[model samples]
Target: MQALRDISGRAGTLLTAMVFVLLLTAFPATAADAGYKAKPEPSSGDFDARKVIVDHVLDSYYWHLFDIADRSYSIHLPVILIYEGRFYVFLSSRFDHGKADYKGFAVAKEGSRKGRAIRVLADGRTPDPDAATIYDFSITRNVLSIFIASGLLCLLFIKVGKSYRDADIYATPKGLPLFFEPLITFVRDQIAILAIGPEKYHRFMPYLLTAFFFIFFNNLLGLLPIFPGGSNVTGNISVTFVLAMFTFFTAHWYANKTYWKHMFNMPGVPLFLKFPIPILPVIEIAGAFIKPFTLMIRLFANMTAGHMVILSLTSLIFVLGSVSVFLGYSISPITVLFLVFINFLKILVSFLQAYIFTLFSAFFFGMAVPKDSH
Candidate 1:
């Protein structure tokens, strides 16, 4: 059975690789036929690398696949807005790539309103800064990526769950199960059990697993330079904040009297320090909030910084190319090599960040659960 499973896995991997190569070969032709035109070379002094890099990394209302000349191939996401007690829904493309207005709303392109949906004035001359108050519920690229990753997670675990039930208890995982079981085990044994303690680890396994896989998968996906992949979902501060909040709530909710007492009233500290100053307890309480805050900022900063550096390197090629096509071509190989190295580093960092976040969460959980009753 082991031999057969290995053979099957190899066959499946080869087949997948072949399909991927075929897609790579065919995508250009299909894109050309679909009206994707070659993008124009950047003119020297006119090329703003900063703008290019920012647009690529930032969240957008549409998923830009590619461009040919002036023609762009993009997926227009839905735009939803709540204004003046009325709800408006439309396609993002209706904004004409941020050049035109849609109904009473238009994409903000300049000034303080950049990258936002603002209401056009009654006379339709300028954006109404006041009345443009909008509750944008639009599904931007980052939001779409989040949904996609979530759906993929559901499909993945559901299949794994089914396999667990159908396969013999002693049998090894064959396909997706084979690929993921080790990761699941690592999270369970190394992270949860070791950090959270075996007595309480089982209860937090589901949260730890969910967080580990979600962050890891999104980080991997963000490294891809293609549609449905490059949207910086995990790098977005809001997303990180929410994830951190989960840990914050879970830790505090499970915290025992000892946890609070240690935080609010230290046991061994001098009485004067505890009563008159109470500095240590105040600091400890602040630390409780700081733990999750650090978690949020740490993940957000690392992932965002990685994306910026990689994009900056790619932009260098273009920047040089703008000066002289030959110079750009000459540096292309070197730039690509650096880019590849960074990508490999990013992959390692992705796993490391996931592990760190999960381990830290477990540590916090353990801290909340007292080792012994006083």
Candidate 2:
């Protein structure tokens, strides 16, 4: 079962990658409707590897399809902003792929606020950083990638749930359930039950499963180099902060009296030490927040670092090509081989990170609710 699941998961991942490549080649031809142009220059640099790498990994208002023969193609996303009491809605294409401003709003193309949605003044200039009145609620690429992954999880689990409900004891599960069952059982037996204890694990299964798959899928999707898969949702600090918040609230919300007791008046500590100081309890409360803060940083740092490394390695080919054709040809093979290795390493890291995040969360939950009375 484990072997089959591994093969199936790998195949599914490969299929998703192929789909991305196809979308880049096939779908770009249609993206012209969304404002494809022969040449849309957003900068003056000939080859800025840092900018290129950073822009690809960061959220954008359009899904960049491809650039062939200096012709750029992109699918514009909705740009929603609230300014001064009025709501504004328009397709991001109005910004001309971040090349122009529209209706007193523009994409910040340079400076510290680069890649952000900004509001312009009556004379069409960016307002002072603190004085900007825009509240952007645009559906950027990262947001779209999240919605796609979410819909996928819903569909997969809904099918699996029905299978479990309808299947007989002797009948075997089929299709996606076959691929997911082993993973589900591993999380249940290896992670949840082992960390939280069997008696209390069941209550937390839903959260554990949801978080594990959400992180895992986003990590994998971020590794792809085309639209719909290139957005680094997992690496986004806002997303990680929200995930950590869920774990933090869950840990305290389900905490028992013993849990509170341990925090306020820890076992084996002197009663006199508790009074007059209250230092230990203060430390315990801070520790609670510190735990989730670590979760946010760990996932974001790992995912973002992996992406930076991969992009940097890939950029070498272009960076060299811009200098000299001979140098580019000489380095292409080595660069490609290194990139292949990095891609494989990224795949492994994706799964490992997902496991680590979920494991630590379960550990925190275990710490909060102990089954045995002291």
Candidate 3:
């Protein structure tokens, strides 16, 4: 329409065209249940053949791969689990999976084929399944990936800060940070500025940044159906809950004296109302905690739902097979096609979830650190 042409400008027109093109090319996939699915049976020999991947591999249906699983320029493995199932599942997020996709954690399972020892564990020599895998869960790929990412982020910030400190020296976003332009801008302008206001964004940027990339990277890697590092990053509600708790604490950490004063001692209150109905203060306090709690659940559920939808669709391929391969084969492409689409959407959602989480966290932090008046 003329309205759309005027609205998007030149870039918008191109983007709109791309959207139409992609959508036109896009195949329709049946709507199915959402979240990762683990199979109770075996699958093809290749790791990709499984339903999903991560710190542990579990059988599930849905999801797909474009470049590779748990890849970050040959950095981390796909975090996942294999639960003796007949399907493979994954999530799409901002992952930095490595090209050298090796395996880890094939602990004696009915479906896994054992390989040579990678390292010695407390139990003794253990098979790596991938043969090249080392250290086992000693580093715990997910945790290690997080730790490494944290370190890398810190180093990057330090470099940026140092550049600022030494005005003569010029250093640009060299590595991972380089890839993040719109992401950082979106976080800063839309997320931090809009949510927390400019004055207070810096105080909370640490937690927000940590959570943003952590979730983003982990989510992307999780999309692949493999092992030792996959979408399980957020699927493990505990992980999300913990991240939420971090935001909870960050928000509460610098709660100004006036903020707490208002919480405990509201102005213009009646005597009797102040006693029981004063529960608003308690409720208000709980709301503070609940914010992040909801954040955790929201991200976890959304990401899981994306995975599960694909899993269910993929499961159709196998489930219908009893009738005939024609049914499964006929449906498989449809399922996979949609799975890929949703998988791609998941990457955006992963970034978005991280942004929303960070934005809200920043808002909470701004609430925590306040001026005497506002």
Candidate 4:
């Protein structure tokens, strides 16, 4: 009875901590979009709905905070470039929000390098053909968000670890550990053990735990309309690609000889297929790459689509306002209602997507292990 009460208390504490972290991570990204309400009047200025949506969805060199009286405010990140064997480092502010060039480099507004730093000719507008090969290593908005999320995760787990280390084995868990204990146990017992089998599951727990929480937290944070939350870390293809690659390499690198043999030659296949066209082997090899590819696309597409849908709905107000104030006013409440519903639905999806990704990863890991080991 006491253990049950203690477990409940810990779960509550963990839920509270999770909410606090989500809010903390949401502020930066939300702040950048705060200026949206201050957009120019519909009567006097042009509003490109597509551009506004795209700008919000894509990563930027500078983090926009808010706008006031038609003035823009933003945080300019550091830009590092290697051009013609010389390193050039400067604040993104030097480009004056894509208006002016500094140190012979400007933010390209068109061509293949749009939204990226490019070397300009003496005219200060035309892109330099010679400097086309410039290498950029700028700290863009998405990269900064990733760093922030990672730091928070490290601090969070460290605190949980300490709580466990200091507590007595028979003592009721409290604080972070209490909340995370059940979740950690679920991943271990339900995910790792069931998929990878008990004997081999322990080795993969570290990665499985990390991937699950990382996706789960980032998905929740992305749903927030405020600062740090809006960065769309998981929605970015590059980030998902890297994560999928981790699973890919982890499975193949530690796979036994039996796993590889099965890939090139199946046990029950007809003899002619193996010797003539080798069709079965070819399909198996392709399946290995295809599995990871699906992981990357599934995560990237889902998160990105959610953000786009919300933004598109929000844009509908301005679009109608441009047509008729009455129409805009009429649609506002409906739009808000839909927004509320979708936001709630997104919360559920955030957890579901995280679970799906982690489960599939575990299943793949299990497949790599030989039946003899189990």
**TM-score of every prediction relative to native:** 0.86, 0.86, 0.60, 0.89
> Which segments of candidate 4 are over 4 A away from where they belong?
1-44
| Highest-TM-score candidate | 4
- Per-residue C-alpha lDDT of model 4 across residues 156-195, encoded as one tens digit per residue: 9999998777879787667667677888998899899999
For model 3, how does the per-residue alpha-carbon lDDT over 1-374 read when each residue is reduced to its tens digit? 97575444645545665465335323333222112222223253122213332213222221222222322222223334332331222221212121112232223323232221122233433433433333322223445545655676677667755655665434343333343544667777887777777777777665676688787766755554443234356755767899888888777777888778767776566656458667768877777778888888998787777666655555666666535768867887777877667766766776677777777777777777767744
Model 1 pairs whose backbones collide: 37-68, 37-69, 38-68, 38-69
By descending lDDT, how would the candidates be arranged? 4, 1, 2, 3
Candidate 2 lands at a TM-score of 0.86
Badly placed stretches (over 4 Å) of model 1 are 1-45, 110-113, 122-125
Off by over 4 Å in 3: 1-178, 227-229
lDDT of 1 by residue, 199-313 (tens): 8888789999999999998887787667667777788888999999999999988888888888888787688878888888889988989999999999998998887887777
Q: Which scores better on TM-score, 3 or 4? A: 4
Candidate 2 error regions (>4 Å): 1-45, 129-133
lDDT of 3 at 49: 18
TM-score of candidate 1 versus the correct structure, residues matched by position:
0.86
User: Which 10 consecutive residues of model 1 have the lowest summed lDDT?
Assistant: 29-38
What is the lDDT for 170 in model 3?
44
